[model samples]
Target: MYRESLKKSLYDKEAVIDVHTHVGMSPRFFRQYGYPYALSVEDLVIRMDMLGIDYAVTFPFVDSAFYVNNTGSSKIETTTEYCNFPFELENRNMLNEVNEIFPEHAHKILPFLMFDPSRETEKQADFMEEISEKYPVFGIKTASTYIQAFVNDVEGKGRPILEFARRKNLPIIFHSSVHPEDPWASATDIVDLAERNPDVRICIAHSARFLEPVLQKADGLKNCFVDFSAFIIHCKLAVQNSPGIAIEDFRFRADYSDPLSVMVKLAQTYPDTMLWGSDTPFNYWIQKYYTGDGKLVEDRLECGYREETEILHALPEALKAKVAYKNNLRFLFGQDI
Candidate 1:
């Protein structure tokens, strides 16, 4: 029944499934900044309803109490000013709470759990295995940068986590960056891991902030996929057109990437691996985009993801639909529809 019902949302329909949305507040928010606003699961449901989004693959905030942002990375300075990095409110049980309210809503919200594998590698794996079986977890996320892991390798620091994923049929979404000193996981590291575990599905999160090294590594690995979740062409255009849009959110450091040009090339060359994901509520903000003359216009996360059709003028309807919906369902879920 669920699979059949899902067809109504897809089957070449222009349905969108945002795979990178977080709900609820993280721990340590009050300590870093007083009176912080969080994007609750309820807020996400309303946004999806208003935008006609078909489904959102959601996750819990990282329980980052053990980790702090003293890395002095440029990305850290910008985001940490407004954000406290996800704190220690994350675990498998937290995700279960979100699904308790899933069925009452119109849109389908698939939830995933976040973990830091470095604490007790073996225990973390066991906990993941248990909850994955007990709950309806679609996948697992490794915010390596947030978790402070070196890479996505089984032999390296994340061995226990990677070993668990290698055996299980579950997919892993790894936070990747191309920077030499990413302070998180690197794209090169993910590529190496994917080569060793060909059967395991891996998503190189955020396109490694548009690092070509990842794409080069993904060339031979069929199970590897690239995500345009947090940053996309439309997001860049929105900032460029609006004078004071930076005031809305500089959390995402799309400093060098031309997401529009890069997206077009990736969609054409690696169409199969390309997937759409909204780093929601993070990206889903009420940003006032002003014209050249400073005339304000109402544009928000509701309109940003549709830039391929509305703004970029490069992606045809068929290709646009593929990037937005088909690519993800087919590749990730192994479903043709």
Candidate 2:
């Protein structure tokens, strides 16, 4: 009885199941800052524990070569010759490390296998299938910057990978940052895929940002949903555009051009279709500025996660429960949660 009560309390209306996280590194670009890999799953867990987040679907930031080893060297290096060193956050080995580190929490964490679909073809599909069969993985992750980060590339190399996911009954989460530089997993690209592969469950990271076309797509497509990772669920931040005319400008307030107000409105509008994600570490932007020559320690919990939890707590209990854990649980486990 106590266990049941505890489960009920933890899975309360405010309970959050973060759908996007990196247990190893930020996407490649952020790695240049000389910060140690924030993808440390242990560190992520501590942060999640502080924030009351029960589970997270982790995707390694991927570029084409994250999964390969040198021809002769038995030691696996985390980089590729085609791309620069340090590779993207989507390293497959990092997924292995995370699973190894938390065997018990492994099921709660869904690690995405990273692949450069254009380059890795059959080998990629084979590895993904093997891992899915051997371990508990949520799905696969692909980056849009692959084409943008390289030259002479057309469209995402993710189609073949998605095909493998379809065969395996897995979901693929794509990062659809509102920012324009993010090219590979744009809302249009993902929408096209979702339309084509109706069985594949696609979670668009960052609530499809200013991608109205993508947001509208979620309304009709049952398999599509948005992840609120970078958006401000807590405080108001400067928006790129006031009127939100363009997709990039839509960052602050594309829905109604009101950043602060849109979160609740959107949540109410699309309750079951939304998933809460801290998108932590990257979310440290909330504390980017400090008023001292010395370090000031703060809670460091992503404010967006906190705010979203509060907002979710305010919802009708049933709806809050549905969005907080049941929604993803249903999508992931059918009826377990």
Candidate 3:
């Protein structure tokens, strides 16, 4: 048998599913939304095949105005979130492109609606709820980090989406920036919403960069999950964020307080609430661009799905299976297979 086939057999036949990834995105453009990258199913499958990634949750990019609002205020310095960014209907249609690609592949590809509202307009959320009916999405992607940082709500920003998740049994993966006070999307903000909306399954992407902020509190919340897709890059960022420190000073440590070690422990801490993801080209590409290296895409665009996945080798087999795919299947499909 092939390597992946042997691994599948070893695991009692559970498929490896990546919970977060974008097929394509327009990093920059003059006309608002830029062009999506090469996100054809073939392109995705090629990468997934290399990593033995069986299924992926794919979505499109939504142009966002994150740091400041339309009202000339800094959300970072403000306590109350102000929904002042302007979004257009035209920008939300990347779902259509994703739908066009994944449907043919059957279980191999799954599509999620990326609905990030720019302002406190119930209409945008309402509009996506109406438009979502026209598409086939297994779940939804809400924003806190990579997208808009609007406060979670029921009428403005992601308000309309709450209804969709409530009605459709849809699991929502949030773009999180929870710890140390991310005005855009924080764990406190997400947990508050998750607590209120008990019916919806919420997965905090990257588990707030795999720190204790999100995981430390998930034991009490049955529907809250944590995904660690971009662990290495986040580790790299931790180093870069502390440039003046020596190389040896750049360590998450190898103890219980260490982020990676915490990931392993959380398997036993909140086993049912942990999952794995590969933010894919989106995470890799955006990091390159934001770090002022997008022009060197060839070097930086190297995929890290494997780096993210192999790190889980430290987990027990059962826990690895749970995070790799079982938890995702249970959360998204309500099936253990």
Ranking by TM-score: 1, 3, 2
Candidate 3 lDDT over residue span 1-337, tens digit each = 2323423442466778788877544433223232234355567777788877887787655443322222222222211232232233223444554445444553466667665544444555565566556655577776544343454643354566677677778888777663332356665567667777777888877655544544556547878787775655655555455221112332223342244665676577667877877777544543211211112121232335466666665567788888887787777865556
Quality of model 3 by C-alpha lDDT: 0.57
- 2 or 3, greater by lDDT: 3
Clashing pairs in model 1?
63-87, 63-88, 64-87, 64-88, 145-184
C-alpha lDDT of all candidate models, in order: 0.58, 0.54, 0.57
TM-score of 2: 0.70
Clashes of 2: 9
Candidate 2 deviant stretches above 4 angstroms? 1-15, 26-31, 34-37, 62-91, 146-157, 177-183, 233-238, 242-260, 285-316, 333-337
lDDT of 2 by residue, 51-70 (tens): 67777777664333453433
Model 1 lDDT tens row, 190-240: 777778778888888775455555665675578888777655533454445
Show model 1 residue runs off by greater than 4 Å: 1-14, 28-30, 34-37, 66-89, 153-157, 232-261, 284-315
Candidate 1 lDDT at 90 equals 56
Error of 2 at 302 (Å): 9.1
Residue-pair clashes per prediction, in order, are 5, 9, 2
Instruction: Quote model 1's TM-score.
Output: 0.71
